[model samples]
Target: MDNKVPYSLPGMTESFLFHESQLIEVGLNNAQPEEVPPPAFVPPCISIDVSHLFTTDQIFPTRDDLINWVHGIAIENGYVVLITKSDSGGNGSRKAYVMLGCEKHGKYVPYRDPDLVEGTRTQKTECPFRLKGRPMKNGIDRDWRLKVMEGTHNHEPARSLIGHNFVGRLNSEEKEQVEKMSKSWVPPRKMLLTLKENNPLNLTTISQIYGACKRLRKSLRGSLTEMQHLLKKLDGDKYVHFERHEPGSEVIRDVFWAHPNAIKLFNTFPYVVIMDCTYKTNKYKIPLLEIVGLTSTDKTYSIAFCYIVNEGTDDYVWALECMKSLLADQAMLPKVIVTDRDLALLSAAKQSLPNTSHLLCLWHINKCVLAKCKLYVGTDDFAELVMGKWGEVVDAATVEEFEVQWMQLFNMCKDKYSNFTSYCSTTWLVHKEKFAKAWTNHVMHFGTTTSNRAEGAHASLKKMLRDCKGDLATSWDASHSLTCNQHTEILASFERSIHRIDHIFMFPFYTNIRGFVSNKCLQLIDDEHIRMKSYGGCDCLLRETHGLPCGCELAGHRSTTLLSINSICY
Candidate 1:
């Protein structure tokens, strides 16, 4: 036991160990930890057509000009290619093209035994992909161009694509989440945050996430050649029309689409339809005009959707003509078409469907009021006063009453506020009949004073076409998804009508009108019944405005019967 000497040094006798004990303390105090080198940059194995990266300049414009060009292309395409090796000329220009490789590719790793394993990992660098370029002289200066592209990976290239870093490439799981989030209308930035929380492996840069989302979206929206193929894949129940601006090029300027339900709904409720344009719905920022109708039950139904290159009168006229052709029965003209205050749309509607009453939306008139007053006082007390007064004046029940009130309101406004009065007189008053409840009392507006149905449809479509970026094919994909959901909702309503009525008063009239009209109409009729009980006296305003029987009509002899009560406006 005494043979063992306790000392930091090994295999020394006791006397030798005692002599070195003082030196051992000094050596331990002077010892330092070994240094570690930083990890080397590795380029990703990415494939791109390198033709755009080349240049024929004699002198590399600047010292880093060539590097910047190649870097820009790689960054834009997503994935990083680090400058691994570089060569230089005497004049500080690139003599020959530099070499770069993916971070996961090339280089030798040190070997470690599993039994004696320390905290170290070896990344397999089998990918052989490389990008090559160099500067050349043309007697005057050095010119730089992409010389060669070499190598390929056994596996796929990258995910988070088109960025300055490798973090832009997405893996399989991240790609799935991206597509799901995109379909749900989650913005790309928001998707990145969500992906980071669930999957901490790949997501790093915004470009990476954007690239992943775009890849799936690009798949959803195929090439232009697939567009013609898409059109041919349609069922016979769909009505699709294509219009070209230039006959020689056959470039489509406008397109109109209508499903069988749309056409059928138009046939049933052709009295009042709304056409509102949704903008920035695709790459061209053209207007996506949604045409919708309201049933007797107040249920909104799709009629048609039109895409026009511009919001001009000619464009509107052509779209309307196409709509008429789709319906195929010019005699079945709509009683009115509610639209925002677009002079071009109104002009086109008048020209194309002269018989159809073109009504301006009251909501649009209200907006104009705000616009006028804001121009006058921004958002002060005067703006509120003018807005309030305008609402009252336009909502007047009778034409005679409205005229008198408008004069009083006008005189008061003119006497106190000249510019606001001028705006109303020169702009809104000239189109009084289009918006005033008095003039449009008998019009079958379905209780709507605006193109809210179209706006609502736009909002719904935006949910499908979230952020609204992409091309023609992408827009069509969004429309198809929304249309399918709409059909499902319509079917559910139909099923409910056939089986049972919920939370609605049941009169014999409900039984009579169940199969004929919508449940919305029956509910309205029930509401009218409740209102009828409270009526001391009545005017036929509800009948005129809503195309339904009023208390006054019900008070008459033939009450509560669909046919005898009051003929529907359509």
Candidate 2:
């Protein structure tokens, strides 16, 4: 059932062809009736030697010239050579060499290492099919020439070179794209999928792309260790201090970094800051603690970041102490620190910045309440009660009113819902002053009631990184890039406020605000402007919420009810 085709080597014509079965049949018919035994079978030559093609003064003029020479020697002998590796370095040689690997399916095991670890390495296609080359410095050849090694290849010569990697090397343009995207942290599979849009399908594989990426990384570092490069970078950083394992160990347990510009920003806008941690972002097996400060524009700026040994109280305490050391001034300490309800971390913050008011993330508290209430009530009615009724109580306007609504809810759920009751008395009551809206509104928390700043930062970091299992060097590089991008965005916002703002507030009070505060703060004042109509009076909660005067307060100034508008200024 086999179809036969006339075959030829590279640069050679097709040879005579005959059906193998027909040839056997014809030989049998012409044989003697006594049919003597056939001669003993002999195997073909396993490798070709080309040492005679080179001399002391010779060299390969170009890559193609070397290939053509090798092919010319083998093509006449029923073989076609393929280049497995080439290193021209722009001069078509450098210690440069082209390797000859057996074509696909032409690959075979070396005579050595038989019975290797089953399924682990024995199945690998590491054919002993390679030869090195270099330019002939003293030979008559123009640039370079290849020499045949001493040992013969242990396997039979390949029949043809139709599907060989040597012939299917990547074109110049594709190699460029692979190198570019790989450095950008683009996955190899994604690089191929993207390139395949403009090229033939199956043109490249993930293995090839990954190889190129690895090659580039190696070339960039030459022979230096990854740690050597990292330490070299740290030498230039004045504000970032790293703590590695004792004297000669390999582990990097903790590292704290505060860019000089970030320190300046912290000094300028130290009123509100937040600390949050992200995990599984690096192979170093440490948690990244991010300290973000809220700018007057309500934008988030990275104040500092550190890698913690663990998420324990001592680890967080060390991180905060490092931050304090970076500032080296108590006045630069944040007036209010916002974070999730990590009690250990909160305790550390208290010890580190005794003057700083600690506030729990309102969003986290609400989410926890919703989760527990759903489990307690286990009905649609309970969800409605928690969301509609309990939500109002949590957002109560004053401490007195909050206590009243909380008691009412407690009275309702104290007996029937054991889970709900235990959560209230044990959890909510213990941390009510930190998490509840009633107590938190008194602090100037930059209006950030959630950990979304940290969450968004984490999402951006993940997008720039290929995987969470990257080494410490990889994570540091990615984080540095994102920090640059964030600062650029912050600069753009500053430009927008100065050059592109549209001030809708025409009144004198609003004009004073527009000139005095940031564009983001102006927007907050505008929201209060809208709220004053619904809840009229100087005692409006808007003043309490944002530390800004309400329309009622402005009206009091207009009607001489207050001596000075400065009285309303927080």
Candidate 3:
């Protein structure tokens, strides 16, 4: 045996250790031959030993023990086995359980039925299994089934309890009681023809009706609270009532509140309020406060109005207070207030609206000039000449130029009015700062620089009140109607004329011019001078036309020559 080979059994062969180098060589040509040995063979051997790390009872004596063991195994090896008891025979007894394999530590945990935990598996029964589906739906279905079963089984008893409680507790018959109450209650009248009449209820009418109602209530010994309650009910139902005695203020407030369109109209432009007063025949002068909005359309619209006391010694304070009330009510403070140069009015406006700029109407200035310059009427013709030819004077760039042109024209007056020139100049020219920067420019174009809007409004009110002939209440009604009607018509006309310059052109321009002339010349000049030069030519005509001097320069010209020549030529 070779040392390299291990010992073998008796059936082994020598060829097992044979190498190719040691193989017997046989040559066909030679007579000698060598045979190779067969490989060795060894018998298979087996060994058997039985020992347990833990007994079956120690590892899994109960189902919980088995489950815990399996859970441990599953955690370690990612696999598990389930053992369940089964019945071996027809007798109801536990037996050797069946073992089932499942994925260990899978995404889902298996749930076992408590009733079947210690019982044997049955072949005929459906196995409990959880599928991959919505857990909420499964829970809801189980609860609904339980509720349905309970509802069906207990329906009669629940209904009996409810009916007993409802009927046994009430003593009165509900339907009969309701019918009796309905028979006793009376329905109120649905309409009030006299109270709801179409005629508008103004302040005076409301006061009268309220007084009558009060008298009726007192005489009849009626409940005042009940009457008030009824009136309140009427107000609630949108029916007319006479409780609000002062309807004028209420109407004005409503008109302003109901239509913010008017406010929007004012806010659309730079606005200046022009206010004034006129005497109504009722022995009371009514101060009319107008909110005038200067539109981009180059037109002024009266957006709001109020009647204050007239601006006079007795009523100026009251009027101003009323104006302040109006402004406060409207929540408006204007940038500029343009009005006639009434001292009381100015003081009131200045004190109330401290931040606002006050402007004296240029129209008033012309009137003042005329009143102060009476003697200048015949000699200098300053008022008449300047009225027509002072476009350059108004357009003068500086105060110096204005004064120079003013004096040049003033000095040309006759000797009689020399003192008048000084007086007029001292009064009107002394206080140029009170007027607006645009005053002269505005007068140059529009002529009468006072807001004719106020005058027009006054005229309109007078016309409407004329029919009432100074009856205060009637006049108030008429004035109110006039304002509303005129504002409506004027706003409509303005809208219509906005695009129609032809219609605008049809309005008389000379009216404004004549107003300016009258305010400036006739009002300021004295009677004697006016009479002296009534038929005579104008005195201050520096620029002549057609040999006959202009009106002012030709005042003292014994122009019978020119008058006769013209007559003769004709």
lDDT of 3 at 143: 11
TM for every model, in the order presented, reads 0.65, 0.72, 0.36
For residues 101-159, write the lDDT of model 2, one tens digit per residue: 43321434445554562454232233344445665553233566566543234344457
**Candidate 2 residue spans exceeding 4 A from truth:** 1-63, 68-101, 104-107, 110-138, 143-190, 193-202, 218-228, 237-239, 242-252, 506-510, 513-516, 533-535, 538-542, 556-570
User: For residues 434-527, could you state the per-residue lDDT of candidate 1 as single tens digits?
Assistant: 8888878767666776888888888888877766567665676677767767767866776676566755535454555555555666666667
Model 3 scores a C-alpha lDDT of: 0.39
User: After aligning candidate 1 to the native by TM-score, how far in Å is the CA of 22 from where it should be?
Assistant: 65
**Of the pair 1 and 3, which is ahead by lDDT?**
1
Ordered by TM-score, highest first, the candidates read 2, 1, 3
lDDT of 2: 0.66
Local distance difference test, each candidate: 0.68, 0.66, 0.39
| Model 1 CA deviation exceeding 4 Å by range | 1-209, 217-239, 377-385, 507-511, 514-516, 556-559, 565-570
Which candidate should be chosen as best, given lDDT against the real structure?
A: 1
lDDT of 3 by residue, 250-349 (tens): 3211111101344455444323556665665343444445445443223455555444443454344444344344332345555556678677777777
Candidate with the larger lDDT of 2 and 3:
2
Q: Candidate 3, residue 111: CA error in Å?
A: 99
